[model samples]
Target: MSSDPLDDVFNLEDRFYTQGYTQGVEDGARAGRIEGRSFGMEKGFEKFLESGRLAGKAIVWANRLPKKTAKQKDASEKSSEACTLPPLPSNPRLEKNVKLAYALVEPDTLSTDNSDEAVQDFDDRVKRAQGKVKIIERMLN
Candidate 1:
């Protein structure tokens, strides 16, 4: 069988095109995965930081609340040196709101998974917690 030089020359362009396409696809897939992971980590950190900040506010609010009983007051006094915030006046509604806010942002109970349901729940909880913080701030002022 006689090979044709013209055929080889004609096919060179197609061969190069196929190889380039394959390499491009592989590179795109790898780059896509890296970018996806980086984005996920950045978003995850932002969410968790907000949740933690809310949780810290809840703790401070809880601590500033007036102690209800002698036993509670004594216990709080023992640790009083650690907190400088003046006790908030005893208001049942304010106390309840503070407690609710704490529960909504409690880090231990929140899920860290990236699944749709988990992310939805986390977002819902954070939104509710932010609302509670606003309410508590209004009550304080």
Candidate 2:
């Protein structure tokens, strides 16, 4: 109680400043992480759309599904299995590439929480899938 008013005020100010600075840093870090994730997801989605992987998958799946006869489709009791699965690729290389491409283009693969990592991953996946798709298209053609 040997009152040094200036000392007390300085202590209080220093404490407040330290607390505010720490809180601000934490908040800024959290915000940055959220923004990074959002940016990554948006960019990934754009790449996914531009890649045409989904559309190609749809075409492949549609082609694989068996067509029903008009009369069979009209019957009250429909067949147990609506779509008969197609045979797997007999060519080893083609099968491997097909599997890799499908895996790369999967929904899970398109989303990442890190912007830089996501963009790089997206680029690699897109290139790999596109290459596989080209191979498949050539085979089909």
Best-fitting candidate, scored by TM-score: 1
Clashes of 1: 0
Error (Å) of candidate 2 at residue 122 is: 1.3
Model 1's alpha-carbon lDDT is 0.93
Per-residue lDDT of model 2, residues 6-108, tens digit only: 8877699889999999999999999999999899678667776866655467356434433447775455134424635543334656555566667767765
User: Which residue pairs in model 2 clash with each other?
Assistant: none
TM-score of 2: 0.45
Indicate the worst ten consecutive residues by lDDT in candidate 1: 77-86
**Residues 38-67 of candidate 1: C-alpha lDDT, one tens digit per residue:** 999999999999999999999989989888
Candidate 1 matches the true fold with a TM-score of 0.89
Off by over 4 Å in 1: 1-4
